[model samples]
Target: MDCCTPSAGRPSTPVAAPPPGSGDHRIEQVSVPAQTFAMGDAHGDGAPGDGEQPVHDVRVPAFTIDATSVTVADFRSFVTATGYRTDAEQYGWSAVFHLALTDPDQVIGQMQGTPWWLGVEGADWAHPGGPSDVAADDHPAVHVSWNDAQAYCAWAGRRLPSEAEWECAARAGLPSRRYPWGDELPAAGHALNIWQGSFPAVNTAADGFVTTAPVRTFQPNGYGLWQPVGNVWEWVADWFSPAYYAAAPVEDPQGPPDGTARVIRGGSYLCHDSYCNRYRNAARSSNTPDSSTGNTGFRTASRKS
Candidate 1:
């Protein structure tokens, strides 16, 4: 099955949010104004199959979104109150980066295309590297599937940001820059967390992180949103389609009506210039909604009711 595919036997009912102010943690939501901005790959030099083509204009209405990704502490609160189990927990395994694995012998299997990803039993959000590896409270929650994120949103009275809204907020009012900061890449360890040296076998950790970092480790974008381009591949509300930009609506496009996989934006700590430079603002990818990895996480958005 595709990486983003939902499990066949999972429950379909939506979980309701808890009573207001019940949870101890709160996500700081930033208000993004209604505006028309250019979206998609403007540089045209991103990695192939990245679907960064046909730059277009998108007008997104005013919305509020989390200023930072949902940290482990935040998700912990949701799970504590709702008693929900992530897809990773239900499946008894989740994809983990080879570097994060403390014991290679524990790996049950490996992803076909990406051998660097090892399927480790018990590797869920709480156990990023399996039972031996516990997640840090301040780190952004990893190994969360899109389905899991939706569940969290439901419990928090929030929703996932649409691809258009995500890109709009990521740009931070900058029209043509390749990243949230600017066109020039920030020196390693200076800005976002991304692959420093070679990918896969060699990660120099120039950004001071081999795995997930604290959610607010880097500087905020112009809009005060943190790490919009790097750290982890964030799950968006839209479904994935390489050709969606070709005929996408100009105003508030949510993405295709349906798709095999859901959209994931921003690159991850594994991103490198040599390969998968999807750290660019317009770059995007997709995976099965049920897929969860150490390099993926998500923020929340709220629309005025």
Candidate 2:
């Protein structure tokens, strides 16, 4: 259960920005006001088709996200004020996660149904695992695409939270809460940074991390947000439909106007609970908005706070 990677094998287009406000890469956001919750998987514990389930409703009107997940020094200050080139650095390669491969000879191929996902070739987002493995200025920037998080939300004027404003700021309005701190599993030890041991074969970092962990590592969700589920897999702006919750749209439902994958919400650091429990808060998954992987990453949104 490699959480995700490998899709849209090339050209999904849309990654040419600069000049929308162009460069502040702001972070700590929050707001999330306009109510209406119960969006999906009211604990039937989804995953078949993964529309999450019939537990519909939704709403989402206030918006303002990004209380975390976008680091690597806020995407290296938007690639140092937009030199910006990442569709896995223009598809030279990405997807590297054979246990975050430090360099087993920079292997440039894998993913025939997730062979622990190892494409490589200088694995992007500032060399994730190939090429001497850099990247980790406070983690959570991984390989970056959904068209490079819409060119870093069009250079940080911000935009990207719309899986019902990312599950109403990851269920902070807490009701069908499998977690954003609700159903159980946090007496303050592993609030997130998933996968304990035995994933692609023995991680045991317990919570300390085996791949991305500091997007503020843990604790913060009653709207303060941080690490909204596991340590990565964010990228939301819709267009993924495992039957888009049958007829989605209780109010703000902006998804599925077209498709070929887009949505992705929490659940990363490889995730486990016997293979991608999807890290919770009515989990979901998708890719190919120009896929990039090392467990994915994104976070930004604002209709103003």
Candidate 3:
């Protein structure tokens, strides 16, 4: 099933932001130097249909990427300044994890294949679980689409990282490593935010969170990028293509020339080894430009101008 699906109902009213802190409005960026790195699942451990095969080399130019995924406070600031409405707000609803909802009636529908995802009315970035839920300011902003991320990037004078750049930065200069830290998965609550225990049905929250954790909840990678593998699936600036990696350029590939959906990299708090092992460095996925979900978010990137 698709990670994000559409919902039916009205959007929730935007929530007021808490008092701004020094870090709230600032977008922290880490400089990723120009370098060539292998950019796909050469190890063949990723899901079969995930299109992570044919590991290839890619060179990315120097760029600055956000240290963390955009936070709720950051998105809130943008909305407050621009009065921008997300696709979710425009569509009136977005997909929310069933575990996040308190009231069963709030679920408008369930995704056919991924029944764990509930189409929740009044579920937007502000109300992650529907009208009654409020996202913590420090949490990574969820229920954001690629379109929403692009808008935020425009407002912030940045852009989404290209898929190549994203993978390079995620690798953190490590070559052929399963994760940012190394080959071995760190003990829960050590380096990243991801599902523990049974996925879809039971989340042990062994990482100290059942859902989205604070943006800086984990240690930064070698490039100083925070939560590069987990927390939320980040939208990248590339159209999806299963075979694109084979023909992808060695120097600064930008994904397919055109396609229906955009690339989404890394994984999210919902990922687990049993079903969704997408949190690996070379793993990838995609979704429609306008799709939003409680487990998706994005960070910004920019040329070192």
Candidate 4:
């Protein structure tokens, strides 16, 4: 279900590259050497989660990836150049975590169990908090749909990172570790950005900010990539199928041919041990391509020749 598709349930379109000399953006290109890597961890953080076991190998060619998640400034430039409206805007709003919803008017006031997420109107990437809100120019833009991300990437001369490439960069040098840094979770005054205190209602900003920090606010892994394990969950260019990896190709796997959802990597600040602990390096999740939220965004990669 994690592959590309239109909101109407049609097949997704192939992404295009953005025009040259785009403004209001800083692009840092990192080269990825051609190599083979083992994908997945046999041990799923000492749990029995589906699709995480039966560790396997994959081979890839040399390529380049964006050094960080796409920022608000860069997405703004894409909007300026293309004059495009995001899907969330077209849909009228997006899902907002109840705790992040400080404004009463913005809260649609419905619980999906944990009392954390609420469907709010006018909560798209541009208006991250809702209709009355605006995302900081430096923060990574949120509430962007896969289609929106695809359009932005095309207009930015980049493409969404394939799931394989993304996993490799996230793993960095320590392929067997639990996180980009290591197995241990963030301790008092030790690592970079992440959610602190209680979920939504009482955030202490122990790692730094309650909301999304500016990209690279956390320490970079050995690959020089930042915020791979926390902050926001990034959309990858692959369909979501829990059993697909069982039959995935050993060389440059591209996931299932067709599916309902798209793959998302890394965990978000919303991650919690009791609810969802997907913040681990090997963890993954998925949602409809049209689904957008304040905690979701993406990075890009170029195919190796």
How many residue pairs clash in each candidate at the backbone level? 5, 0, 0, 13
Ranking by TM-score: 1, 3, 4, 2
Task: Provide TM-scores for the models.
Answer: 0.92, 0.34, 0.91, 0.87
Backbone clash tally (model 1):
5
Clashing pairs in 1: 3-288, 4-287, 4-288, 4-289, 5-288
- Show the colliding residue pairs in model 3: none
Minimum summed lDDT over a 10-residue window in model 4 is located at: 1-10
Segments of candidate 4 deviating more than 4 angstroms: 1-25, 46-50, 109-114
Off by over 4 Å in 1: 1-25
Q: Write the per-residue lDDT of candidate 1 for residues 1-305, one digit (tens) a residue.
A: 22222222334433333333344449787889999998988888654565677888889889998999999999999888878888888778888888899666679887776777888888888889877898999899989988888878777778899999999999999997899988898554568988877667888887788888898897999988999878888999998888888999998999999887789888888877776777878888887787788889999998754
Which stretches in model 2 have alpha-carbon errors above 4 Å?
1-33, 36-61, 64-81, 85-95, 99-103, 107-121, 126-141, 144-156, 159-174, 179-198, 202-232, 235-265, 274-278, 282-293
Please report how far candidate 1 places residue 304 from its true position, in Å: 3.9
Each prediction's Cα RMSD?
A: 3.3, 16.5, 4.7, 4.0
Predict model 3's lDDT versus the native.
0.81
Give the per-residue lDDT of model 4 (tens digit) for 1-305.
21111122223544334444534446676677777877786456523433666678888787888778888887887887777777777767677766566456866654344346666877877777777777887787888877788877766667788888888888776667778777887557336455666655787777767778888776778777878777888899898777877788888888888887788888777665554667777878887787777788888888766
Cα deviation of 25, candidate 1, in Å: 5.7
What lDDT is reached at residue 50 by model 4?
32
lDDT, residue 216, candidate 3:
86
Candidate 3 clashes: the total is 0
